[model samples]
Target: MLTELHIRHFAIVKSLDIEFRNGMTAITGETGAGKSIALDALSLCLGSRADASLVRPGCDKAEITACFAVAKDSPAARWLAEQDLDAEDECVLRRIINKDGRSKAWINGSPVPLAQQKSLAPLLVNIHGQHEHQLLTRDEHQLHLLDQFARHNHLLEATKAHYRQWADTEKQYRQQQQAKADREAQRQLLEYQVGELDEFALAEGEFEQLEADHKRLSNHRSLDEASLFALNALYEGEHNNANGLVQSAGQRLQESVDMDPQLGSINELLKQAMVHIEEAALELRHYQDQMHIDSAELETIEQRMTQALKLAKKHQCSAAELYPLHQQLKSELQTLIATDEASEQLAEQRQTLRQAYREQAKKLFDSRQRAANQLSDKITSAMQQLNMPHGRFEISVDHDNQAPATAKGTDQVQFLVSANPGQPLQPISKVASGGELSRISLAIQVMSATQQTVPTMMFDEVDVGVSGPTAAVVGSMLRELGGQCQIICVTHLPQVAAKAHQQLQVAKHTDGKETQTDVRALNNDERVVELARLLGGDKVTDLTKANAKELLAS
Candidate 1:
């Protein structure tokens, strides 16, 4: 329920603040008195598209704020929480339009994008324009409105779920078919690459080990000569060589062992060192004797190393990475083969899902038919009170089992009407004039709104062509609806305005220098005067005042 609305520099409204109530509130004024300005201001905060032109002629910007008292578990509250903008049980939506046409929206004092404001609007308020009856002629909207009124959420949700399953399966099937040729091409590429890598049979660290072997073979003669020189110098040197020096040290230590007991330990250490030096000298000599190079083996090693480097460059990888790359390619090949195996199973799954979609759609079609009948009767009965004495309203559903399923279901729904006797029922859009449509729209909205979860409903100029007893009937209908939710009605009929629990009178005040629009909540006597002006003219007679009082009493 909307608790308060504030408008500043919006259209002709310089500054206006009004508190709203839970039941019906009527807004009325003479022509050019800014009667619709309040509704327009509320709409801005409700996410209607904004323009800078809406700003009061001399003002720099226009701003509107609407505060709603929301239920904890309502959709509006849930949306606010989802957006992280909840403020206890109150939700405030604000919009600002600058002179340069820039607009900003906010929820709970936090800035939000325009799209978010638009999304939350419907959940908070449903505004029906004078021409919204034309929307009833569209199939989907008709179907949707009927569904809302019928409260067939279970069937609708089940159908939607089944439709999603079918759609996903179909999408998958089409993608697989489209990719068949491409997958085949990829398969051939994978096979060729995998075969090449398998034949080469690369291993981890193989590149480094092979390079070491190649270097050793390529310089075999130089290594052999160097080892021999070192062996001869260390083992066969006549003086100052390693083996000779070690022997001399050991003998000296042995000579001193008798004088000092510590010298005996040093003497044994010298003996062990000399033995180790001798063993090293012999090993070097053996190495020199065994050293030899095979040119053919060296050539083979060079060729193998060159081939590995070339393959690495060809695959855009390091020599050591070749093995891992080969493994990855093989894994992908196996997955492709598995996809081939799964294709047959996916076809079967698609068929099963398609059948499920059809069955659910059938159920939805049957439910819609039943809902349409009930909805038509309700609205048709409502139409009679709104001045359409012979008006007949209907919801027509044409179910096509063969029609390709849409997300909504397989039935085409439309509203039909016959405003006069023997007129022959026609599509509502063709049969109803602007006035007739307004009343019919009122009836439909009243019927639909009773079943809606939204807490606020606003009707702009809904009583356009209605007057006399018919206007009272429309007023009564709105009043009845107000029992269930808050209603804000912009009307011209005094009878309609008189029936409201609250009356707001819109008036334009002008001086030679400035002009402004003001809206004030009318008290009991003030309401009677406003109604008298509506019933009479610029000058209200005593009779009109009495009639106004009588209207209010009714």
Candidate 2:
């Protein structure tokens, strides 16, 4: 339950500190007395959005803090543990909004994201404002309420899991089917690519070697003629040869050796030179005899090289990459063919999952039917006690065939009310008056007592459109609910105010220059005065005071 609330520079509230306690507490004041302001501040602390306009005129920022004390084994204790925040027995939630639309939130005095703060709220407090009753018309909330009443969360979770699997399988199946039309076209393209590349059959390093061989073959005659001429001039000449000339020189030098001793060294050098010339003449004869040219082989090499270059250009790759490209294309085409087969297999699995989801959804439908029957009875009884004697409540669970399998279920639930006898039961949103709706909402709340998750509930003017005996019953319902958990109600009805275990009266005053709102816990005498004021407007007559005293005594 909420322990304390503090508001600073929030709206017209400069600074306010209020301590709350167990049981039902009534907050009452005249029009424009800031009764809604207190609820607004509490809502902010409970993770509602904050705006710059909420700040006081002269203040730079607005702050609201709510403190809660929970049991050791409560959901909040586990939440704090999960978040790694400091937790003892109490949790403090604080929110601050600056004048520039910037805001901050804290959990247990540790800085936290706004989403974390919002996540923590449902476990601590449940606030039902005037507009919240409109949720009765929504399919999701109606199904949610049915599930809560049924206490079948485990089964609901199973249904959701099965539905998700079915949904995902269906999605993949659709995508693959959409691609099937293009699959054949793509496969043919890849096959053609593979065939084109295969014609090259070029080996690594073969392109360079072939180019070199072709060049040599093309210049074969020129190379042979040049070598033969050079050899004839040096050694194969018919008139004179290099070997004979060198031998003649050596003989002449030997003859001159008799005249000079230095001529003997020159004769030996000429003899060695004649031996090298004779070796060169033998090699030139072998070279001239071995030369042979083939034009056919050269033409074949040129054709092969041209084909390799053309294939490389068409594939946007080098001549050496054609073989690898062929292998890659073959692998991709094979996979595409396999995908068509795999897609059929997945379609069969999707059907299986859909069947599973249908079985799970049927179970949910049966559970909701049973729960809705029991809830309708309980709420109808509650409405009778709330002064709607002729009112009838009904829950319609209609099957929705066209709804998605992954949605809440195959059922569309709606709440209907007939406020008077002979009036056909119509949708709650269309037929129930504001006062009747308030009572119906109260009835539903009372019926789902065990399903309430939080230990604290605040009803902001739940008695707004109710008065007379209905207002008294509304107060009784709130007091009865207080026995199980804390209840805070802001109201303008004396019947409701007089039933509270504690009453806080909000009043505003101006000191000629500044206006301020204050909330003070009313004593027994003060309660009478406040109740009398509520009953008689600004004039608390003796009869109204007596009536107020009688209500307090009861």
How many residue pairs clash in each candidate at the backbone level?
Answer: 0, 0
What is candidate 2's CA lDDT for residue 314? 88
lDDT of 2 by residue, 1-554 (tens): 99899999998888998888899999999899899787899788777898999998888999999999987788888988889974789999999999997999999889988999889888898777776677877778777777778888778899889988989899999999888879989988987887676666676678888889988888888988887877776677775667667778888888899999899998889888877777776787787777777778888998998998898898898877766777788899889978978898998999899888888888888888888899988888889888889888888887654567765678878888888989998888786477788788877865675467678988888666778988888788888888888888888999998889999989888898777888888889999999999989899999999999998887
415-500, model 1: which lDDT tens digit per residue?
A: 88999988988888796477888788889988888888789999988777777898999899899999999999998899889889
TM-score, model 2 to reference: 0.80
- Give each model's whole-structure lDDT: 0.87, 0.84
> Against the true structure, whose TM-score is highest?
2
- Lowest lDDT 10-residue stretch of candidate 1: 230-239
Worst 10 residues of 2 by lDDT: 399-408
